[model samples]
Structures are given as structure tokens and as C-alpha cells.
Target: MPSPRRTARQADLLERLVALLVAEGFASFTLDDLAERLRCSKTTLYQLAGTKQDLVREAVKHYFRGAADAVEKEIAETVDPASRVQVYLTTVAEQLSSLSRAFLDDMAQFPPAREVYEANTRLAADRVRNLIAEGVAAGAFREVHAAFVGEVAAATMRQIQLGEVGARIGLTDSEAYEQLASLIVHAVSS
Candidate 1:
């Protein structure tokens, strides 16, 4: 069944909810806390989702959805296959720059939110693979195993999201992503 369309007010509330969670993390926020922070009532929050956990999950999904759209939009503006791959990863990094360490830790602890991130990572890997394949076909990149590169990139992204990369290398997730983009572009260049 089709879901009911969101009203402008609900959309604005959701955007605000996403920004607040991205800035501060959601695990520490109670429904009442979200209500007060968002300047809405608990009942209004319930209209967005049924419970606090669901609300957090919804916000995480919303954040990724918006990020995906933004990445694609930027990629569309770039013509070269190599540049597309670079643009894709760098845009992803930019989108993720807003995520606080607290938010990453909270996502790791929350299975639903963690799963959303995992699924998004997998999709991004596929996108990288496609972009690399395009570069090879276009002669913008040398012949290399696109799938292997994509999987490696995906693994790095997972570690970045998990905070393992930062713990070991002291690089923020965004920095790691930018490095990954550069590495992939260099590796694929003819």
C-alpha cells in the first residue's frame, strides 16, 4: 500500500530531526528529549515513528537517503568516468562529514541503524564498481578488477563507519573516504 504523503510541516520536522540526530547522536535522546529539542510534543514525534528506537532508525534511513540523492546529483554533473568515481566518493565523504563520533558510536550500538549503514555501504560498493567499469570501458582507466576494487573500498568504508580506521590511523571518516577516493582514482588511471 502506498504510504500517505508527508505534509510540509512533517517534512520540516523530519529534516530537523535528522539534523539534530546527526549533530548530537540519537542513543542519548529520549522521546521527551527529542520532543523538547525539536520543540514538538511526544505525540507529534510518535506521528513520525512508533517508538524511540523506530524514530532513530527512521532518522538514520532518512539521513542516508538524502546523502545518496546528493551524491548522485553531484556525480551527474561530472562527465568523466574517473571524475565520476572521485566525485562519488568525495561527495559521500562530504555527506558523512556531518556525522559526529557520538553518532557513529550510537549507530554501532543500535542494530537497526547499523544495518541501514551497512546496506548503504553495500550499495555504494556496487556504485563504485559500476563507475570503475565505466572508466575502463571508456579508456579513462586501465584494465583492472573493478569488483575487487569496489569490495576493498567497501571494506574500508565499513571500517571507517565502525571507527576502527580512526582508532588505528587517527583519520576521521571523511578523511579516510577522501583518501580512498584518491587511491581508487590513482589505481585506475592509465
Candidate 2:
């Protein structure tokens, strides 16, 4: 195992890398550029995170983990399943809205980043599936396939992220979330 100091330093490096990615589109920067931005040497970066792809994967995972934690907190605080689902979707939508446009633009420019992106997407989907399964077990939702509902919810969120449908409807992130929550509740509730 790594020493605590090493672990903390790695964490800090990861945060800096993520901040750089969020600020400057990923396509605009090379590893050397990232090292310059972070005021560190490329060797240090390689030591901290194996490769650029690994760094991106860690950054994406960290981002999604934070988002999932926020949504889980909202779900835990709500009483009813419907309200919980609403809070969850709303939280996700709000997060997506808060994301830097440069970040999205970067994802569009660098297709390799999609691998990391998709991993985060799968993590989010798994969380939704677990939430749905819990609601079903608690006799809150209908007798449908939790996995299917979770996949659909995840796909819908991705659509929103891609700016395919939700934004066109004048749905602020919050409004889009409310709409999604309503749809999910209607689908799952008997």
C-alpha cells in the first residue's frame, strides 16, 4: 500500500489535473502542458498517475463519485420514493448544468476520453439501478425490472448531457430534472 503522504499527494495531483481539464479543454493540452499548468514536471505526473488516459479515467471517476454522493444524500433525506427519485434526477441535472462548457467541448474533440466518460456513465447507471431495486424491495415502486428502468434513466441523463432534447424544451437543469423525475415516477409506480 502507498504511504498516507504519497496517497494525499496523489489525490492533490488528481485534483489539479481535473481542474486543468475543466478549465482548458483536454484537447488543448498535452501532458507537458498539464505539468506546466500544475507547476510540476512531467515525470512527477507520470509517477502520480500512470498515463494520460489513466489520469483522465481517475478524473472522470472522481467527478462521478462526487455527483453520486450528492444524489445519494438527497435520496436519503427524502421520505417517499417519488420524492427521492425527483431529488436524485434534479441533483444530476443541476450538476450537468454546472459543468464547464469547455469540458463538454473537450469530450467532443477527444474521442478517447469517451472511454473514461462511459465508465462514469456506467457507475451512475449502477447507482440508479441500486436505488430502483431498493425502492422495489421496500414496496415503493411497481413490479418492473429495476435494471431496465435504471438503464433508461441513465440513457435519458446522457441525452440531457449531450444537449439532444432537454435544453430545447426550455427546461432549466432543474426543470429538466423535475420532468425526468415525473416520468420516472409514472413509469415505476403502479
Candidate 3:
């Protein structure tokens, strides 16, 4: 079932919650801390979500949904399939580059939030696969296994999100994604 609609105030509060969690991370914050930081009562927050974990999950979902929408909006404007692939990944990189380490670590540790991220990663991989397929169909890219390439891209994204890319190569998540976009485009181009 669809969720009930939020009132303007509730919507505003949820937006604030998403921003706060993204900027500061949610793992250390208590409900009381959130209420105080948001300048609203705990009661107000309960209207947004039942518990702290639920609130964090909701906020994470809100963030990713918005990011996906923005990426799609950018993709809609680009005409070339190869350019679309680059735009899609780079746009995602731009969206994610703002995340703080604390927020990312918290996401990794929190099962619900982690699941949201994983699901989004899979969605992203599917998107990449489709984009690759389109490129091949348009004769913009050489024939390749789009599904396999998408999974490879997803695996690289997983590593980037886990901070492994940063640890091993000293590349920030955004930089790694940019590299991935370029590499994919180059490898696929005829």
C-alpha cells in the first residue's frame, strides 16, 4: 500500500531530517538529539516515523529517491547513448560525493539503510545495462554483454561505496565513479 500523504509541515520536517542525517550521520543521534537538533519535539518526529531506526531508514530512502530522480532528469536531456551513460554515472557521482564518511559508515553498519543502498545499486546497474544496450542498438558502442558489464559496474560501485576504492587507490567515491564512467564509455565505444 502507498503511504499516507505528508502535511506541509511534516514534509518540511522530513526534508530537514534527510539533510541532517546526510550531513551529520544518524548512527550517533538519539531521538532526543534529533528533536533538539531539528528544533522540533520528539512528538513531531514520530509523525514522520515511528522509531529512530524507521526515521533513519525513511530519511535514507528519501535521499536516494531524490538522487535517482535528479539523475533521471539529467538523463532525459541527453540524446547520445554514450553520453547518457556518462551522464547517468557522473550524475550519480555528483549526487553521492556530498556524503560524509560518518554518514557512509553509518549506512554500512545499519542493515535497513544498507539494504536501501544495495537496492539502489542494483537499480543503478540495471540502468547501466539498459543504457549499454541502447548504445549497442544505436551503433554507438561495440557489441558486448550489457548485463555482465552492468554487474561489473555494480561491483565497482559496491567497492567504492565501501571505501575500498579510497583505501586502495586514494580515489574518492566521486572520482572513482568518474573513472568508471570514462572507462565504460571507452571500452564500449567502437
Candidate 4:
């Protein structure tokens, strides 16, 4: 087993590397490429994972988990139901702002990374559904089936990621998500 200090140091390295992975991509970058970009030795990166694929998968998972946790924390601090959903959407967009198209495509190409993304998507949908219920109860939102609306919102978000809505409308994916938050807030406003 690795020493606790060594494990902590490896975790720190992963944190440093995830941003590079987001801006560049995982699919095409070699281990040497990653080491050079990170300004670290290849051996140091190897200590984080046995192989490049494992490192990419683990970093992608860490990114999603960290982003999700931050969103949840922000939502928890708010009592306003409308703000809860808005916070969720806004935080999601902000977290993904640095992510490049190439990086996103790489995630889609990797099954393990894709699974991590999909899991976050599902969790966001559930949280949105709950927020809708809260909003309706508090009369902050119009009377509607919260579950169905949340599912629709989640589905639309997926299309935005696919570049369908953003492509036709000439907006980036991050911009599309911001627009979506606005639309959702207005649609449910009482």
C-alpha cells in the first residue's frame, strides 16, 4: 500500500492535471505529452495511475465529482427554490467553461469517462426535479408536473452538449446552458 502522504501527494497531482486534461484532451495526448504539459516527470504521473487510460478516467471522475459537490453546496446554502435550480445550472456551466470541444469529444470516446459524465447528468436531473417540487410547493413556480419538466430540461441539456441547438443558434455550449437556465427560470416563475 502507498503511504498516506504519498497518496495525498498523488491526489494533489491529479488536481493539477485535470485542468490540462479539460483544456487539451485525453484521447490524443501521450504520457510524455502530459508530463511535458504538467512540467513533471513521466514517472510522477505514473505514480498516479498504472496507465494513461486509467489516469484520464480517474481525473474525469474527479472533475465531475468535485463540480457536483460544489453545486450541491451552493444549492444547500440557499433557501429560495428558484435560486436552487438557477445555482445548479449556473455552477454546471461555470465548471464546464474551460472544457474544450476536443476534450468533450475525448470523454465521449472513452467509455469510463463517458459513464462518469452520464452519472453526473442523471444526478443533476434528480436535483432539478427536487428543486422543481420545492418551487411549486412554495408557489415560486407555476403548477406543472415537476418530474416531467425536469426530464425535459435534462434532455434539452443533452442536445445542447451534442452541439445541435448551439450549432444552429451559433452559440457555444456554455452559452447555451446559460440560456437554458434563463428559459427554465422564466417558464416556472409565478
When summed lDDT is taken over every stretch of 10 residues in candidate 3, the lowest stretch is: 1-10
**What total of clashing residue pairs does each candidate reach?**
0, 0, 0, 0
State the C-alpha lDDT per candidate.
0.91, 0.70, 0.91, 0.82
Q: Please provide, for model 4 over 56-112, each residue's C-alpha lDDT reduced to its tens digit, 9 standing for 90 to 100.
A: 987887888788888888888988887877887888888778788888888877888
Encode model 3's per-residue lDDT on 88-143: one tens digit a residue.
99999999988877898899899999999988888988999999999999999999
Better of 2 and 3 by lDDT: 3
List runs of model 3 lying over 4 Å from the truth. Answer: none
Q: How close is candidate 2 to the true structure, as a TM-score?
A: 0.73
- Error of model 2, residue 88, in angstroms: 1.5
The digit string of per-residue lDDT tens for model 2 on 21-118 reads 76655766778888888898988888766888666656665665677787778777888765566577767776666556677666645565665566
Lowest-lDDT window of 10 residues in candidate 4? 1-10
Pick by TM-score: 1 or 2, better one: 1
How much RMSD separates candidate 1 from the native structure?
Answer: 1.3
**Candidate 1: lDDT over CA atoms?**
0.91
Q: Local error of candidate 3 at 53, Å?
A: 0.3
Model 2 misplaced regions, further than 4 Å: 1-6, 109-112, 136-148, 161-163, 166-178, 186-190
TM-score of each: 0.96, 0.73, 0.96, 0.88
Report clash pairs, candidate 1: none
